[model samples]
Target chain A: MSQGEPGIELDTSLGYMLKAAASALHSAMEAVLSPLGMTITHYSCLELLAQRPGLSNSELARGAFVTRQSMNVLLQSLERQGLVIRPARAPVGRALPTELTDLGRRQLEVASAAVRRVEQNMLADLDTDEQDQMRRLLRTCITSITEPPASTT
Target chain B: MSQGEPGIELDTSLGYMLKAAASALHSAMEAVLSPLGMTITHYSCLELLAQRPGLSNSELARGAFVTRQSMNVLLQSLERQGLVIRPARAPVGRALPTELTDLGRRQLEVASAAVRRVEQNMLADLDTDEQDQMRRLLRTCITSITEPPASTT
Candidate 1:
């Protein structure tokens, strides 16, 4: 019945499946994170800061897949909560580099382990080779969409 | 320097790559759909209705991977815009069965095609076998996470 239209076949569409997988992972992460009073974006910000310290607000937003304004709001909340801190003035440029407080790292240590367990559970059924294959396919798809159109490139 | 923690390695983590792929596809879809005045969730709701004419608000919420409250808000807006219709009273159960208007179908035709293009672009580099592999891999991951943990199952 749907053959006449160009609508995506939800059962077979790679995009839909990708979304479902991502959404499942997100919900699982949230399940683990929420008990500790963290949202995915909030946990993401702290994790990013842990791995790459002194990242600016804009960079953190990009890394967290959020807008700069939303990241700024989160930063302010985190600051008030003493989870993160930014200097009163930019030492080098207009961007204020953000850092995690001692409390932040302690919180992140717990949250990170929970998140890792969720990821591990998600991959529990798959073997190493299959995990690698999934990773490759996902990376290929990301490159296809993120890179410039073929005509321009 | 960072060997002590369980924090996910952003570069090698399958879950992180899954998120990146989904986010890229989401951005690509938004780029196309926004020009036609649609958000992904907005488009998802219409598309779900087109494919399943009698889906209830809760069912639509499940299909679209959004909370019931968010789906309720979207439905109200869609109803006000004359894109969808529900009976003044429930026809059968407490759930209100929703169906799209002719206008909604017409709008969906255009947005569906645009979304299809975005999906195609994302899969441009993959062969049929690779696409099938990705579908299998994604389905497996979804199942692993969504099914009861092995102890309970």
Candidate 2:
């Protein structure tokens, strides 16, 4: 086949850069969280529950960018570790709503502080205006990617 | 323990927003690439090889944000499929360098175009200046996360 258009120039590709930034952020978060005996996904699950208590397993999976099965496994481990709890049965549906336990909340406190510092460090160089602009820009990109693709015909 | 500082406000946290954007972009890429029979990591491996031929397994894993073991598994699969090749023995060090075969390059062409379209869609609303700003912003964040932690004393 005809040589495909020159492959995306990695240096200038926004998508590549986005992945790089995300990867770096993930590694940094892991470095801090691991010492606290938590993984990034574990921390995310607790944080999501704190902000929006009783999120279902599937919801946490979506929020954490992991498969439902993986989240289910994590939830099980968290439950065993006494970090979160779920009713023996779903109160209203098949989705068992989850919440942080006292132990979980206590654990989250230290991890949250560490995580906040990581985030603050990440944005230490950007001013408030620039941070806002970055937020808006990121939201725009997210919308474009998530929205239905336009007619190509 | 004393109540830790309030957890990061999910809505306003740049780090959270960055993860959201990256997640969205990844899902979008997967949607398009899957029909082409490529997972996001698979596509990333091919793309990286095309851009920087002879990347070692560990390097590819780092670039793809996967563990070295995972990358090794994928490399074995790709090698079996005749899409990539490595010498029977390392030329010098123990790192066996990988190169894409002609078939691999052709496959990458299609995947690259699909990925580029996804990236373009993500940036459809941003002007050149805004895109440049985003690039700069992402680079700065990546650097901050990767660089050694500043002295806390």
Candidate 3:
């Protein structure tokens, strides 16, 4: 159906709107990042590693909202590019700790600028207040879903 | 950086927040839909087809925010499941038209209820006003990016 059709079949719930906006924004991001030979998923992993030097695979996967298997595949790809390095082993555990290499750091610098440009272009219509409100609402939603319930005691 | 770090390298932009929220919501959706043997991508395609019976592959891809190649793979899978039927030729053009089968409509009915539960859980915290505002802002963002500029006479 077209935009103004009566009784459109799609449910205009908050989740549906969020999914549509995210999908559109993701398409824009992929277009922007494609020239740099990075998918948004790759960039997200690298960005998280840049900020946190020695995150375990599970930790990174959790932060990136990807499954551990998917994260492992992404890590392997980054490693193959020599942009990320995994240390031999963690001091306290058997887990492998991943850190961005110097090349990866520089790449992040470039990717960050590209991402910022895309973000600005996407949000050009909203004033600062509206933007802030949107962010707060999203954060609240995320926290409510992710946090565990308090004990009844 | 840890949460207390003075300068954590977070993007904190509207696009970033939107992406993060969408990612989390999608993961939740996938978890709920997996037992029913459906990815969100597949469910989306089925949903659109159920609503509009004769959508072309390109039109479905555009509505679902996926590449034509990806859409082709998904359609093949759905057709194999006996949920979708693709005509060899369309009245308008050579491009094929696809519609949901009887099984597809029933699948969608079941999946829609599960999806609604996940969505309700996600939005359980927000009051009605917050939910409305969230939907309005997200719709505005989607429209701003997707809509072409007005023609200058």
Q: Candidate 1: what's its TM-score on chain B? A: 0.91
Which segments of model 2 are wrong by more than 4 Å? A1-8, B1-5
Chain B TM-score for the candidates in order: 0.91, 0.93, 0.84
State the lDDT of candidate 2 residue by residue for A1-153, as single tens digits: 112435458868999999999999999998899988899999999998888888999999998889999999999999999999999999897999998999999999999999988998888888999999999999999899888778461
Which digits, one per residue and each the tens of the lDDT, describe model 3 over residues B56-88?
Answer: 788788767788889999999999999999976
lDDT of 3 at B77: 91
lDDT of 2 by residue, B1-153 (tens): 122336977777889999999999988888889899999999999988988888889988987989999999999999999999999998877888899999999999998988888898999999999999999999888888888778531
- TM-score quality measure for candidate 1: 0.92
Task: Answer with 2 or 3, whichever has the higher DockQ.
Answer: 2
Cand. 2 Cα-lDDT = 0.89
Q: In candidate 3, residue B147 scores what lDDT?
A: 62
DockQ of each: 0.55, 0.49, 0.42
Clashing pairs in 1: none
Residue B92, model 3, lDDT: 64
Query: Per-residue error at A138 for model 2, in Å?
Result: 0.7
- Residue B32 miss distance in model 1 (angstroms): 1.1
- The 10 consecutive residues of candidate 2 chain B with the worst lDDT sum are B1-10
lDDT for position A30 in model 2: 89
Clash count, one per candidate: 0, 0, 0
Please list all clashing residue pairs in model 3, or write none if there are none.
none
Q: What is the interface RMSD of each candidate, in Å?
A: 3.7, 5.8, 3.8
